[model samples]
Target: MLITFKSKSSPEVTMYQEHAERILDVLNKNHTRGVITAAEAAHALQLLEQEVALSKLHPEVDAAHANHSHAHHLQDEDETAEMADKNHIGFAQRAYPLLEMLRAARDGGDNIVWGI
Candidate 1:
């Protein structure tokens, strides 16, 4: 399944259901296929745009590296390696479009709606 976040302010942002669910989970929002208010989108955008060394969005990334003293341990272990890679892909590749959609939705006083 796919979730297409549509808004009046910008072009629609479409993502796989899994990635959308992960984003919603990090924002503490229910993963429902319906309209999301501008206010809610703004709140999510603010957190996404924060100037932090580590984003609160991806805890698994930090936990993966923090598990062992040596960096080689991350490469040696399949779980940690996969976790790190998933975190990187989720935060970097998946989050960008979501952030853009939120920003535009907030700025234009638009609501985002997903699903068919």
Candidate 2:
């Protein structure tokens, strides 16, 4: 599975190779205790990417609303900001389960997953 990072700047879908590599390393080392599959890592990484994108978009949307003069556009931007904030929070909430899974897999073995 491929992991990507989303940002509002130039590169929106940057590959999270380092994170993937660390997860793979940990899984490889701890395969005997319990398997941390690629699917789990991919899900976690996708959630993180969405959280990052929402975080980046929130500030940009707020700034655009602040500078704009059109009332209609401002309202839309405000709505968008609220939605993005909710998404960011939702992504974080979703991440906790993945984190707990990773932690449990880690605690079951001697190896630790780094760079997550």
Kindly provide the TM-score of model 1 when superposed on the true structure, using C-alpha atoms.
0.64
Tens digit per residue, CA lDDT, model 2, 10-65 = 13222234324333343343312233343454454455455546645676653343
Per-prediction TM-score to the true structure, in the order listed = 0.64, 0.27
Q: What's the lDDT for all of these models?
A: 0.67, 0.40
Residue lDDT tens for model 1, 71-110: 4555667776565655444344567887888888888888
RMSD of 2: 13.9
Q: Name the top TM-score candidate.
A: 1
Task: Specify the highest-lDDT model's number.
Answer: 1
